[model samples]
Target: MTDSSNRRRLRVGGLPQVLLQWGFGGLAALVLFLMMLLTFVDVIGRYLLNAPVTGSFEIIELMVAALVFCALPLVTAREEHVTVDLFSHLLSARTEQTRAVVVGLLNAIILTAMAV
Candidate 1:
């Protein structure tokens, strides 16, 4: 092979993507860890010390919500969400892309309605 043909274009899938994915995972793990630790502390304080961690319930609820919200984009980007695949395999590639775009538009409309 000639050197010109052997030269591959530089790809942008190295440390950046790895760091982004890992950062998201780390955030999720940190939230989970904090939740568990807070719960444990709350339990210990209530049962052993006769005093609960103040606002522990609210804090955990907020943390859980934040974790889920933060994970949504990552999940969508990864295509790890459950999807109805009925007729998807039968569709041509172009048709599938069109369907996906239309579905996305519909989702946006529904979301906008709900928001309003």
Candidate 2:
């Protein structure tokens, strides 16, 4: 628990990583903004004009998926995923380390398969 360790790391992946994260992060933000706008328009049209936006549901569905994917890199880079450590007290340190390695391998395999 040194002061240096407590500080944030520059592992944001240098220039390339920074560009990538900014790009994807911006895209995710744009998609989210569009979704909000779409929802607002749809609501206004549905309630005030008596005409809902056409294909709004489908558009929102697709946008939701895109948003998730666009934000994936950031999530992976920051390791901001959910953790359910229900049995953490029962597991030894080595066991926890082993489980992490196994999960990482499985994740890599799955992601590779999906990419292909």
Best by lDDT: 2
lDDT of each: 0.75, 0.81
Structure candidate 1, residue pairs in collision: none
Q: Looking at model 2, report the run of 10 residues with the lowest lDDT sum.
A: 1-10
TM-score result, candidate 2: 0.81
- Model 2: colliding residue pairs: none
Runs of candidate 2 exceeding 4 Å displacement: 1-8, 112-116
Question: What is candidate 1's lDDT per residue for 7-91, written digit by digit as tens?
Answer: 2211234566556767887898899999999999999999999999999999999999778756754664454567888899999
Range of the 10 consecutive residues with the lowest summed lDDT in candidate 1? 2-11
| lDDT of model 1 at position 64 | 90
For candidate 1, the C-alpha RMSD (Å) to the true structure equals: 7.5
TM-score of each: 0.67, 0.81
